[model samples]
Target: MVYELKTKENENSVIEFIESVESPKKREDAYRLLDLFTAVTSYPAKMWGPSIIGFGSYHYKYASGHEGDAPLTGFSPRKAKISLYLSMEEGTYKRLAANFGKHTRGKACIYVNKVADIDVEVLKEMIKQSVNFSKKMGQS
Candidate 1:
């Protein structure tokens, strides 16, 4: 069975969204991430769903035939933690992640309390790899 993708790119203002975040720290960190991601991905910020700020996008179809469009890299300034969304397979970068700094992670989302908790250099490398990985997958 095919599942519909709930998160999608929308015509929303990323700056506006950042300004709406309640926490002053989160809001500032959101702006920092916006600059960081934009500089790394070299793509303009785009909103994915109501919360996530995304960069470049690509389409993917799994072996099971599940397919959808997704950002190559993105993040959401959630109430609990900032969610860093990257496209590489979980654990595919264990060595790299070891130096990624204070964070918890799931399959695709990395949770961080703030930007200061992570090594920005490591995040940049991860974002580059993720963009390449997603682009390659879409080409297949």
Candidate 2:
């Protein structure tokens, strides 16, 4: 089943979750992630799922018989890591990741532990690329 978007409800939970993290470092990291996502997308950030703070959204379907709507790009601040979504397309962001510093990749998401652990400038470029990529997807 497709997950329903619960922007407001998720935002509240994210606020509470961030507040409950106990570690000031983690809380601050969450805030920074929030700031970066908000600044880059220019789309107001909203929480997705229990931990994900998402920005602009789009819908997609795959040949493998899967389809869904997802944030065009976003991230989650987990207890142990931060997750960034870049959406999906062939070769769109492959080169950018090389300079992104320490990170792990899933199908369309990048995971990081802390902002300081990566090259912020490169991260910004990746965010720009992802947002632009999403916009293009919307048009096509």
Candidate 3:
């Protein structure tokens, strides 16, 4: 049996989704992040599934034959922490992780308790690199 990807583009309003965040501080950070990502990626924010606010896009396929198109970079302001989605190969993520301020990680996603706890500049760099990497992967 084949399983489908759970996350995909949706028609939900990005602003509304941010507004729905229960934490006022998180909501504000979401807006700030939306602006920053939009400027950096030059791609409008789009709702991915029900939670993630994504920018740009690229297609990816793994050796196991799983393949799909996903946002080049994105974030989701969850109840406990904000989830940053990025792709940093060649130990780039490790380098960033060293100076990323207070954060936790799981493979591809970085979790921060709040935007203020992390360096916004570093976050921007991560997003930029991820976009470039995703574009190259798409072309190759």
> Which residue pairs in candidate 1 collide?
none
Q: How well does each candidate superpose onto the true structure, as a TM-score?
A: 0.92, 0.78, 0.93
Model 2 Cα shift for residue 120 (angstroms): 1.1
Q: Please list the residue runs of candidate 1 whose C-alpha ends up more than 4 Å from where it truly belongs after superposition.
A: 89-92
Instruction: Rank candidates by TM-score, best first.
Output: 3, 1, 2
lDDT of each residue in 51-104, candidate 1, tens digit only: 999999988888987888999889999999999987675576787798999999
Prediction 2 TM-score vs. true:
0.78
Question: Which lDDT tens digits does candidate 3 get at residues 9-118?
Answer: 88899999998999999999999999999999999999999999999888888888888989999999999899998886858887877777999887778899888898
Candidate 1: 10-residue stretch with minimal lDDT: 87-96
Per-residue lDDT tens digits for candidate 2, residues 57-81, read 7666666755555677777767778
The whole-model lDDT of each prediction reads 0.90, 0.73, 0.89
lDDT of 2 at 100: 72
lDDT of 2 at 93: 61
* Candidate no. 3 TM-score: 0.93
Which pairs clash in the backbone of model 3? none
**Residue-level lDDT for 15 in candidate 3:** 92
